[model samples]
Target: MPLAVYLLGLAIFVQGTSEFMLSGLLPDIAADLGVTIPEAGLLTSAFALGMVIGGPPLAVATLRWSRRRALVWFLAVFAAVHVVGALTTSYELLLVTRVVSAVANAGFWAVAAATAIGMVAPDAKARAMSVVVGGITVACVAGVPGGAVLGQLWGWRSAFWAVAVLSVLTLAFLVRVPAGRGQAATGLRGELRVLANRRLWVAFATIALAEAAMFGVFTYLAPLATGTAGLPASWVPGLLVLFGAGSVLGITVGGRIADARPYQTLFAGLTALTLACAALAVLADSGPALIALVFLIGLLGFGINPAMSSRAFYLGAAAPTLVGASVTSAFNVGNMLGPWLGGVTIGAGLGFGSVAWIGAALAAAAIATVALALTLRGRQPVPAQARA
Candidate 1:
């Protein structure tokens, strides 16, 4: 593995920790700020919304800088935002801070793995990208659990402070990595043209739909557990650990699947996702059933991420960075929509089971997107659709 991959992993760790810690700390935040849990959850939505709005504009605006400098400047902005987030007391102020932090975050994801892939040898690209993305799974497996523990031990705000410190470490490590081959603005403009292709939209749709369903329930999982899963509040953390473990497996293995039979794995994963969501919706009446359902959902849902990512990589070989960031933006789009829909359903007195219905619908949409991608890719007559 290149040093760049390690640095990307670390950056992702802090970034993931910074973004994801909201769920673990929400209860504490609610208590401290005198707000309902649902209202407090806007912190997560605010971040997701930031990523959705910021991913492209920032990437396009920073096109003049080398990928390395762009990443550094992004990390710098990200670190400052975390500091601001830690200091803010008013709920509205914190919301604004989270939006700023998420902008930096959107830029980081847009460039980091794509930059790392450029740094290493060609044969090493897939492995390097996997290692870079692995940080997200690692965050779920460890960083988040640790943050949750810290929240339990001290306060929710401390976790953000911890992420801020980690950001510094990530920045220092990232500084040492070579910039690799720099991308030009022409390449970005070329990427914009590529984006207009119908197949690319299909691929983006596939990613967005899958993410929305997966995260929708995940956002409100703690409550989902209490409502339908029947798991005790104490058991939620451990269950999350299990989900993290499965996610680690998914991320590591997803790459291999992409290398082997990309389309097959994708279709299978989407199909399984639909079935899993349907099954969970039907079975989400009690503790043990919900536990089994949630685990199955996590295992199956996260298992295809690498496959989906790689599919986009191959399909969008024209403009890697733009497509890469666009896929991530699609991810946050799902992130924003899923929870909002879930919250609406829950607020409407629809139980946790309603989440599965949404999940199933999204899964169906994802499969349709994949079908469209495969169809368009197979029929693409022009050898050079755009540029890489």
Candidate 2:
């Protein structure tokens, strides 16, 4: 990998921190802005909705621009929006900033993935992607917690200020990003045509299902850790640290195998995910077993990103940028849907441990989706260009 690839990862680290730090700061934001916690929670949802709605159009609009320029512009807007957010006292204004900042953030991610892959060899795409996506896991471990501490010490606004500073620092590395000579410009019509493929849509759905499986259980992990696992409230932080560590390890292992054996890796990852969730569903009351399963769930749950992203790249070779955007949109959609589904399960009187069952079922659905894609590949004739 080139230095540019690592810099792209660093940019993701900044964006990921800003993206997730909102969760930690919600209580402070709610109190200060005179909104309920649920209303403050809407800020998080608004950011995700912005990402889902904004990524593709942004990708299309920036088709003619150089990836380096797009990246720089997006980060500049992101930093600016965070500054505005830090200064705003109105909840309504804060919500607007969150959405606008997320638009910028979505555009940055769409370009970043394409840029990262473009800078690496075809065989190294998964490894490169792992390094980039690893930024999010690192954010969960360090950035979110740090933001909470910053919020406690100074104010919630301080967390936003810190993110803005990091974004600015990250922009300095954009000079290393390689310049392009109009490849994106030449593909407008052909790239748009790629959207017609049923296979590509299936690939998008697969990514969504996989993420839903992961987040369904993850969104309730703290509660599960305390209630079912019988751990102390203070242990939640350590549990988060453990999960993040497991995710990093999973990404590393998945990257090594995904490029050459994408579906094999997919099956392996989902299988591990299913088994881990199933164990949690059944043995969550046993402290030792619950602890081990939580770590395994974290490891196996996130371990599929390389395979999943690699699959998207393969399916969307005609429009890599759109594929990048699609992946981002799909993940956010899953992020929202997963927690909602888990919430429904709990509201229906299934305990927190039932979230693991829901998660396992979601993973099983992903596994079946992968199998369906493979079956369709065998039964249906490949498009001439696809075959080529």
Candidate 3:
């Protein structure tokens, strides 16, 4: 815990807020643009697509910059996107702004994890990364709900304006973060060099599958809770707070588990999450049971994030920067794919309950991928604490 860690948390908070606030603002955007609710959801898709496409390439390209300069520059870019997003009136212009925002997001996250790890002692890496990612959970607890309120009161556009202001503040404080050189990813060639490892692909598969499961259900969660659970639309906000609570618990518990044995923890988390997702989807009819299972899914599903990320870090020892970029890229790809796939299922007449099934399937796939990685390594088992 250096003072810089707090800045890292704040930076992530701003990023997470900008990224997730769209869910609550969709109706306002849809009304303004005269699009269907489903179509308006593309705002999220646009941002995620930008992140997926930009993350690794940006990481590879910016590998030459010092970490502090890179972070400040990226945050500056991130802030500008939000500013444009706040000001734009044309829906098409808004989409372009979101893409710009996505580019900043992609680069910021890739560097943020690497920067956070580099900031701390080797043993403290997991804790530091967890603290940084706390911003995402904070968004769940505060950002989404706050944005909803902001959108309702001042208009949806005001939420973007609010985010723009916060982004500028984050950039101002980021001056306090320590500067350092990031590993040069060289370019696409450098990135491909790391991808040369088959094991790395296994790790990527695991990351993608795990996120696919989590986001598929989560992206459609508001509708599912309302339609399937027989709950009021207004209750969606309160329920999301509960989801955030579970996520906070899961991330902390999982971060500790990762310190013990990152890959082993991934194995267990994936398996447990798969079960929880399956149970939730199958039992959505029961009010009490649905709440309990949704919470369980949130708890188990999110617990794997740090471990899977660390696994990428270890497996890509030869190319830490590329690995960092690739992990984030994989994460975003899953984010995009998850919602699109879930939306497709629903459009094809599948019930909201299928969200959990999609999640369960992805989790099971992730577990199998990681288990295979463990078998191939053939590393002699060490005691859990020693692994940490």
Candidate 4:
């Protein structure tokens, strides 16, 4: 890996922090803005919606631009939006800022993934991806909690200010990254054509399903830990940190093996994830067991990420930037879907433990989706032009 790859990861770390930090600031935002807590929560949904709808179009628009230029522009926009969000008194304006920030973040992610992979050898693609995606897992562990502490000390706006500052610093460092368009710098038409690949859709489905499964359980983890698992309320943060630690470990290990044996790695990780969810559903009453299962769930859930991401890039080889955008869109779709499903289940009077059941079912579906992808790949191998 080159220094540019690590720099891309650093940029992602800053963006990832901004993405997840809101979980801790929602109450403060609602109180300050005179909105209901649910309305404040909508800010997060707005961000996810923006990412889902904005990424592919942004990718297409920037297809011919230099990667470094696109990245720098996106980072500038992201930093600017956060600054606006930090200073806004109107919830409506803040909501718009969140959406704009997410769109910029999505654009940056799409370009960054393509740029990082372009900096590395083919055989090292998964490892390079792990380095980049590891930013999010690390954010879950350190950034979210740290943001909460900042919110407590100063105010929620302080956290937003912090993210804006970090994004500017990251932008400064990212200026040194290479400025070339990636290998698949095909024009808009060629990139759009890649969207017709059935196998690529299958890969997207696998990624989406896997993420839906993981987040279904994760969204309600604090409640599950306190209500069902009989843990102290104070223990929730530590459990979250533990889960994040497990995720870092999982991605690290998955990165090393995914390139060598992608399908096998997916199978092992998804299967373990399904089992972990099932175990959590059944053993939610046991505090120690619940704690262990939370860590295991995070491990197995994120462990498959490298394989899924590698498969997307492999299948969409003809349009790396567009495919990267599509991958980002698919991920946010899952991020939205999983929590929605969990909320529905809980609203229907199912216990928090039921989310684990939902997780299990989603993971099983993901396993089946991966199998279909493998079959599709076997039937129609990558075209020679794409392999070029």
Candidate with maximal TM-score = 4
| Candidate 2 lDDT, 1-388, residue by residue in tens | 7888888888888888888787678889999999999999999889989988889889888888888889999999999999999998989999999999999888888888888877777788888888889888888788888888999999999999999999998888888888653246547687778777777777788888888888888888878988878888888777777888888898889888888898898888898898888888999888788778778877887788988887777667667777788889988888888888899989999899998888888889889989988988887676553333
lDDT of each: 0.78, 0.84, 0.79, 0.89
- Measured against the true structure, the TM-scores of the candidates, in listed sequence, are 0.93, 0.95, 0.93, 0.98
Better structure of 2 and 3 per TM-score = 2
Ranking of models by lDDT: 4, 2, 3, 1
Please, what are the lDDT tens digits per residue for candidate 3 over residues 33-126? 7888977777787888888888778888787888788888888888787777778777888888888888888788888777777677666666
Measure candidate 4: CA RMSD: 1.2
Candidate 4 wrongly placed segments (more than 4 Å): 182-185, 385-388
- TM-score of the candidate numbered 4? 0.98
Tens digits of lDDT, candidate 4, 305-358: 988997888777778888999999989999998889889898999899989898
Which pairs, if any, clash in model 4? none
Name the regions of candidate 3 deviating beyond 4 angstroms.
184-191, 379-388
Among all windows of 10 consecutive residues in model 1, the one with the lowest summed lDDT is 379-388
CA error at residue 371 for candidate 1, angstroms: 1.1
| Stretches of candidate 1 exceeding 4 Å from the true structure | 120-126, 185-188, 382-388
